[model samples]
Target: MALTYLRHQLHLHRHKIIGFFLLALLSSGQQTLAQGKLKGENLPGYEHKRLRWGFSLGVNASWYQLEHSELYVEAIKSNPDFSVNEKTGIGFNVNFISSYRLSPDFVLRAQPGVGYHSRAIEYKGMPADDDNGIAGGDVTQEMNTFAGELPLLVKYESKRRKNSQMYFIAGVKPSLVVGGQKKGSEYLQVKSLDFAVEYGVGLDMFYPFFKFAPEIRYSRGISNIHKPSPGMFNNSIQQLNTNTITLYLNFE
Candidate 1:
């Protein structure tokens, strides 16, 4: 049932979720036909430069990859921990990029960013019917986090195809999280720092003045964020880590 509900939710947001692929496909088709009569290469001299700077704005969906402990499964079988669920949430980011060209096909980049995110975890169990728990239903704890992120990335670009090029990037992103309910909540404890590895692909479209890149990335955390909870439902969680997918547009 939960999987079905998640599929339905993804279906509702299909455009947002799959827009990057559609754009990439459309641009690939444009590359073959649009460059036949162009005067010179796209961004004629931009790639020759050594230092470049840019800014980006993006939208993201953030969630957790939860790993259940044996205790949690046992607790469920014992009927004290009925079900545990997670719901991903939308997020936004603003970033500044500093780039150093390493070669025609490779570049080193550092992008520092700030992001806002909200994610929820639902824990359903036999309620004690007390103030520590929700009165009427399953306990849903929503956490809003402000993240400071620093990513060191390397970009590998394909040869120019008309006014567009495709690139792949891989990097490490370290984040410091703040302003979450973890500080005072009776349930749902999370650590403040997270580290993740990221990989992505993008299409770079060159205009007369600047370059625009539409990118999609998938990132997974290497560090566990879950902390043991003193309350009933939170105790059932053994491992929780970050999972996120982001779509970005960069102005460079």
Candidate 2:
């Protein structure tokens, strides 16, 4: 009787062990199925990551002027036409963007980059005909300036479902006068700190691996670049200021 009791006990233990394994298998299978369903549901929402480093190349019609220069006004007369002819030129900019998605509607980005700009001013007549002309000079004057610039911009991206986005940006750009010539001779020696306040609007287009941003910005110089002079008619010259408009291409 004791042997029969032992046999029944062994059989009960075996049945319990089998039941536990069956329950474990069912639970594991259910979990796997649930995971598969969740993956399928989320597959469509997953987007590929964008690149962090990119290059930009485009053309810029840049304008450059002297800031609060009495010389310029004396050169142009009381009319004080401060507008420099738009120089049709080209520039290249490269960007390294750190993009973070704050929410579905907002993406914050920081971009720091450098660029090249060229500008020129052509005059219609020789200064010798007027009192402002260099003594005994009869040649028309043309000025060409080349600058190197670095810009930092913080842009606010708009919320939209389309491939394009509109942004407003405020930034600072410091430029160095690399080269300048008037009448084929050195004209103006600029300062080391050429600082400007930059504000602009931009458009960005999204692609699979990269984004293209084209921007138009206006910059106003804070410092007076004009050399002070003593003359009753120098007020118009002293009022001359420097500003610029830039077209830029950004990629990231």
Candidate 3:
């Protein structure tokens, strides 16, 4: 009788342990199911919402123009005998961007960008004429500048189901002149700093799975960037107008 009682007690204990383990397994499964449902609720409905970080590299065909100033003509005519060539050139830029969704249709973006620029002038004409040339004699001038820029823009996505979007951007970019020089012997110094009010329109085409976005932008600078040479008797004016078009690849 005692042996039978002991065997019965052992069997009861084993059954209890097995029951506890089964209960724990069921509870764990329930928890996992509940967590999965919560995760599904937090998933984004729009395709673009999945894009939050990206990088962009592109080229900018830039036009650098001097503002209209009476002093400009005066300076060219100081010697009154040389011709001046003013022309815009091409440039390149790279960018890193971070995007944050403000709404289903709107996003805020911050982009830090860098670029290289070049412009040139060739002087020609009669050296003896006072009404047509410069005091520096016949000369050619070429300037190459490197600039760093940062832009913060609010972007509006198109409501269409296509992968294309249109955006209007307004921002401020301050650029520093890192390198430049005149071709001839005339001593010239470019201004070290330029501030611009930037406004532009851009279009972006997103690839499948949000892997990359290729975009094109057109922007205009609203400030002048010229500093007159010192000790001049006239009110020397400065010109600082820039027009830039950029093509970028945004990777998210």
How do the residues 31-110 of candidate 2 rate in per-residue lDDT, one tens digit apiece?
A: 44454444433223222333245555533333345333445455667434333232223333444556655555444555
lDDT of 3 by residue, 1-252 (tens): 332244335543323433443454345445444544454322235445635777777655555565435754766666555444454445567778888887777778888878776544444552432332336445545456777777777777665334444565566777766555433223333566766665555444344355344455666766665555542211223565666666555666
Residue 15 in model 3: lDDT = 35
Score candidate 3 by lDDT. 0.55
Expressed as tens digits, the lDDT of each residue in 53-88 for candidate 1 is 999998777777788767667767767547778767
Provide the global lDDT of candidate 2 against the true structure: 0.47
Give the better candidate number (2 or 3) by TM-score.
3
TM-score of each: 0.84, 0.54, 0.63
The lDDT for every candidate, in the order shown, is: 0.76, 0.47, 0.55
> What order do you get sorting by lDDT, best first?
1, 3, 2
The weakest ten consecutive residues by lDDT in model 1 span 1-10
| Runs off by more than 4 Å, candidate 1 | 1-42, 129-136
Best by lDDT: 1
